[model samples]
Target: MPNTDREVHLRKAVLWLQKKDPTTKKIIQTIGPCTHKMIGNPYYVLIRSVISQQLSVQAARTMENRVKEYYGNGKQFPKPDVLVKLTKPQMRKAGLSFAKIEAVKLISKAYLDGSISDRKLSKLNDQEVLDLLCSIKGVGPWTAEMVLMFSLDRWDHFSYNDLILRKSIENNYGIPMNSKKEILEFTSGYSPYRTIFSWYLWRASVGIENL
Candidate 1:
């Protein structure tokens, strides 16, 4: 459950979205107010996003659990120092691919070197945060966007790099999102509240076939 503050914010965001886009309004009416919680630590969420790339949800969860179990008794996420020490063989044992292991290492290194500072990130705007995260070797715009939306709980974030979102917009809005410009133009109406829009779209995508 969202806290009192988040609940109020969700209400406002939903109302704003309902007025901005008819399709998303229908989704909000069907799903009710957004109840999604942002619970993960910033670095942990980034690492999990890396693990999740190109994998099914179940597979990603399995791999993430394996890493946790190997390093932190399956419950706690490893600290940056511990995670940065992961060897190729150890990561392989935890079901991480070579590329993902590198990404994880680079993310861990950023944390250890103070390149990724939680306090500093908390002060940044959405674009600033994206710029900082995307500066790392393995972090892309998509990963940075996840950090903004999932970890920082930035309500305005909309990632053109997220295929699921593009498809959801296409299916729900009946608009072709073949290009970034089209997606941006369509989503621009929900600015400063696209996170709410995204949460509802994720819900709508669950049972929608052909997505």
Candidate 2:
């Protein structure tokens, strides 16, 4: 089910961003609304983000579809036992890289072993979630951030590690690209609404004027 209550949190963040700076306001005005919230399950979020890493959108989608097909339309994202049932060659036929196959299996193992669960994850704070997620193989800060923002509906998140976001920041601020720390420092003013700003930045990076 959708977390309707999180919408209030996001709305509050939008208000905060409007008050923080004129640039944010301009970006908000340009970008009507953020519509990036498509993920439902944290497991699916992890899987999709992992698949998307360093790959083009079309490639990622193609692979994702293949995996979904392999799992009968991904009714439950394939449990650990289900995943383990498949051979490495079968996973490769589903378009997963050898490394990704291992990574997904590891995540499935974590899930089945009761190391991570939706209920447990719901009780943890953002940093704790990040720490826990990064402990798994093939999952990094960027993928964790996606889960936080899209799946968990966190209002405050901005990935300085995202190159497109960095490019957009440079373009919007008319400044040279700098370190992640510097970018984070510069974006501090838009706290709580950094995710919204990130949406705009990503849009701008893609030459989308409407944002």
Candidate 3:
């Protein structure tokens, strides 16, 4: 429901996935419809993803909010120009590690310099987008993958870097994460809709009904 514009498209993807893989179908039936939240601002998405690295959900939210409070207006995420001005101490006060602080700065700089503009990225293919984002020193494959799913809404992405997705695939289908070839081969069936498949996998991992 998060992406109203893509509801019909997602429904089609869901049906395709249900037919393509039984494990994914089961996850969809259990978790309900795909509810991938799409954000228009790629810069905001990338920065938040950086902040969330290696942290619990609650802890990451707290830190992200504190950073927003310091550099942003109210609860709104700060713009690249605003966030570019953030000092190391300010980032530290918000619980960002030294590496994370550097990552944040690099992301903000990428936006400001037009190395990764939203408009420009929107025009590129998924691989191109990934390459452009990964060119930044702090942005990794995982962060770039997050942008593809949450920001650009690319449909075919499945991140091997996402531990939750890897675990869910292994738990549900007995596909070991270490077997990159097997994982890619298995997930290839959901091509052009793997993003939806991945969304269901994430929901299955957390037991959405219990929540």
lDDT of 3 by residue, 1-211 (tens): 3555578887888888888666667777877877676764688788888888777667878988998888788677788887789788877998899998888888888888877788998889999999998888778998898899988878899998888889888999999978889998888877888888888888888643211
> What TM-score does prediction 3 earn?
0.91
User: Backbone clashes per model, in order?
Assistant: 0, 0, 0
User: Where is model 3 more than 4 Å wrong at Cα?
Assistant: 1-5, 207-211
Model 3: lDDT of residue 90: 76
Which digits, one per residue and each the tens of the lDDT, describe model 2 over residues 145-170?
98887778676789866777888888
Go through the candidates in order and give each one's C-alpha lDDT. Answer: 0.81, 0.77, 0.82
Residue pairs whose backbone atoms clash in candidate 1: none
Q: For each candidate, C-alpha RMSD in Å?
A: 2.9, 2.8, 2.5
lDDT of 1: 0.81
TM-score of 1: 0.92
Ranking by TM-score: 1, 3, 2
Off by over 4 Å in 2: 1-5, 36-38, 74-76, 207-211
Give me the candidate number with maximum lDDT: 3
